[model samples]
Target: MDCHPRGRGRGRGGRGNRNEESRDVRLSKSLSYALRHGANKMGLQMNSDGFVFVEELLAHQQFRSFSLEDVERVVATNDKQRFKLCNHPEDGRLQIRANQGHSVKVTDLELRAVALDDPDYPREAVHGSYMKHWPSIRSQGISRMNRTHIHLAPGLPGEGGVISGMRQSCDLAVYIDVAKAMSDGIQFFWSENGVLLTPGDAAGMLAPCYFSQAQRLKPSPCEIELH
Candidate 1:
């Protein structure tokens, strides 16, 4: 997977990813939570800061493969009000000025978030709820986000910002779904090149008995279907 890193993120012509050296650490964090805690169990809900709290507990890197771009797209669609934060959708295109400069072409921002559902990402809780369970998720792994308290970003609720937070700064909100890991898990691959499909839709959901029984979360992986 080209685990070798290129060092800290540098602002320039192009930065494909953030801290590449942190890949294994990040993936380990993600896998640890999904297997041990069942992040999906956390009843997913969007906070005003533009994050969806998946109380079940998740790893730091669950959404590693997922781009900040995905987060931006979801906010625009999931919460209609978020559009106010955007430049203005025209011809179904999300056009916005960037901090670096130049405009990035965002097509169907709504579909972006929807596509992330299947990236096998860790559940994300708000600041308060995440902070309350932060100890467990980071140390042992396990959280009940519904009952946990968290903090809000205090930033404008923009879907793009949400993504930029992760992919760029890799910071938007604090998530605590790191269920105590210590075990191997499953990996889903496409039948072909995987260019035609992704685990991003309802089908991407990875719900399981352990997720429900141990985590007490919902949206069983069974609810989703395979192509």
Candidate 2:
């Protein structure tokens, strides 16, 4: 899943002016793009864990106008908590990484493996998509595409403990049979932000057979039988 933070403006009584808020949003998007998908393309040296030195990142041309504090602000104030800042393993200097939703091959992330028998396993897992893509999805199954994993939400938006998985504007919700998929040897992992992720089969495709049901959530709510 290539999830990026929604650029949310500050509240009326929040810190910083409109200009600062705009800058923060711009910086957040740039960081999201680089850390999740383009660190290598951007020539930033990221470790296997997906961390890049804050200093090195600041030196990039796109961030010349930004500062370390700006990065900290973005991380601290992000509504979804998409980015993480921590000290480098080799040195005391600070580094940053995307929490999840990486297109890059990040080997190490704080993901908890969810077994079928896990007591806390989600009762429902859904992937949100649009009606326009339902035909292709129904035929080809859900593909991770360029992302490392296919992202699923444990529950819909506004539900308790649900955040950062599916988009709010999504009209279709494909419910996955998590227990059935796990019983069939498909691995499921829970990200730090509560997103359910799976690498799928060897080909990285979650076939329609694993989909328990599909529902049209917008304009109206109705069940769709997958053929």
Candidate 3:
């Protein structure tokens, strides 16, 4: 249910204005799910560059409130495969598998938690692709930007995966009650994308930054709140 703002993959006229009917359907379903199964708690983490906030809906409080038993009944123990079409990154490894377009390359993977307090949250969602990297960004440019784009689960009973462009643009869905989050006193910020409103700022969103120590340029400014 990775609903987009209808501008996905339309950079410089890729598909700008060419809306897809199926995409619309998917967006609708995702919105419905987010709203229906509102989350209560959020997970936030900090880093050297910025804040990384994970809604923690998949395995945290959101799941607990929605029916922890259900989540426990379905999700895998490791929860590693929760995200779909993962790839083992390598240097200049673009076309490494059959599903290349869906396989994004990345180094120094990290996670964050975002609070989901208000009910209005998980509704005022931002739509776009995110495949953010530092070195790749420097060498490739905006055209080579990869971030979260599509969420594919097939609704096959117990499988969900957030997919994006190779090595970057790995899309994910975060349910947040913006109004309530501010009121409850919690925020996990990355770079000022100017997509948010209060304690925030834009819509020209950036990539899903990956902050790691093992990999150079593993994504700086990737921070999140501790509490």
Instruction: Give the per-residue lDDT of model 3 (tens digit) for 1-227.
Output: 12111212322222223443333334333322332222111232322222122233333432333322222222222122221111223322111111111112222223222345433233233222243433443333222223221221111112233222112333322223333434445343211111222222122222222111112212442333211
Off by over 4 Å in 3: 1-41, 46-61, 76-81, 84-107, 110-227
RMSD of each: 19.1, 4.5, 21.1
Stretches > 4 Å off in candidate 2: 1-16
Better of 1 and 2 by TM-score: 2
lDDT tens readout by residue for model 1, 1-227: 11111223322222344553254335333433332233334332222222222221121345546333332332233211122122222333222211110012222222212122355433332221223333343443222222111112212234334321112222223322212110213222211101111121133222221121122112221121111
User: If scored against the real structure, what TM-score would every candidate get?
Assistant: 0.17, 0.89, 0.17
Candidate 1: C-alpha RMSD to true structure equals: 19.1
Q: Model 2 over residues 1-227: C-alpha lDDT tens digits?
A: 22233324444434568778888889999999999999999899998888898899999998999877778778878767788888755566788898888998998887899976789898669999998999999999999999999999888777886777888899999999888788888889988778899999889989898898999998888898788
How do all the candidates rank in terms of TM-score, highest first? 2, 3, 1
Specify the highest-lDDT model's number. Answer: 2
Output the worst ten-in-a-row residue range by lDDT, candidate 2.
1-10
